[model samples]
Target: MTAAAPPRRTGPVRSEGVRLAILEATARQFAARGYDHLTIEGIAAEAAVGKQTIYRWWGSKSALVAECLVEGMLLPHRLAPPDTGDIRADLTAWVDAVLTLLAEPQGETLLRSIIAAAAENADIGRRIRESLAGSESIVGRLEASIGTAPNLTPGAPFEELSETLVGAIVLRALSRAPREPGDAARIVAAVLGPA
Candidate 1:
């Protein structure tokens, strides 16, 4: 008797439309039920996709949700900080862009939901952090810009300074007030010291 050939199992096909649908579904899920109640099945149904498809791409619920947060809430919407070899101008522009994004009506809600999800689930928190580990995040962007700027000593307190700048922006963003004209400049000066 002839031996039968094994069936070939190709990997899952990635579709941008399906991914967008999943992301949108995740956003709706967060809006409707919050992260505490989010479920793979629920998201699958909301996205009209099979559970295996999500698993094939993201592996776990937290990973999927983390991606949703990254794609929908935290990043991808962010603009690149201009690299003008001037830390003051670059940072001011960066913070101003963030302030504008956070000023949107749903922005606060999105930020709150992600934070709440992280607080509610330690696993989700870790996954989100891990997922973001590779991100050239705000701090990384600032460090890169600082590397090109003048007046910073080698290993100057870039991490702390970036944190200070970001923290100020986040705190101000939570207030939902119109951005003061001096806000960006003030934050920049605080970090890099005077234009």
Candidate 2:
């Protein structure tokens, strides 16, 4: 839960290949062993890089994970909301993807670990929130979809709707509760009204 020191700017320019390998290794290790058990040494050995290499770039396990999340290397496929021209369908598909991830043991563990790390570190928390809400993020996609809909509620709160849909799943994951089969459709309806 330590803050990431600015990456050494003066060192030999970082090798993109090595950086990617480290991220891949971090994801693999995180999936195989939950975050609590993941270590820089394990990642370094897996990626065939030295521990100092990871420390030099990422500074801490939480920081490394934050980078992985931002780079879309933490999950199997990037969780993008499909733009199928039908906002309801697209939103439902997106919510389903999130639920699919949370339904898995690894995904649940990863979310829990990230939440724990963010809770213990303000910088990590800020990075994650920024990434999740950024223009290229899921919320941004939701905003785009909502903007195109013809019959949205007058003055619909875009950010709130985006957060509510995703936040519901996050809350479910954090509470260790099973999501119902109709949860996705219901959430989409709640956010967008009957479609």
Which candidate gets the maximum lDDT versus the true structure?
2
Model 2 per-residue lDDT tens digits across residues 62-112: 778767876777773637667666778878888888888878876776777
Q: Candidate 1, which segments miss by more than 4 Å at Cα?
A: 1-21, 24-43, 49-66, 71-79, 122-135, 147-151
- The TM-score between candidate 2 and the true structure equals 0.75
Q: What are the per-residue Cα lDDT tens digits for candidate 1 across 1-195? A: 999999887886699999999888876886577656778899899899999998787666656666677564435546456666666777788888878777765456555655666776677666554443333655555556645555365776655666677668767876666778878888778777665
| Lowest lDDT 10-residue stretch of candidate 1 | 129-138
How many pairs of residues collide in model 1? 0
Q: Least accurate stretch of 10 residues (summed lDDT) in model 2?
A: 146-155
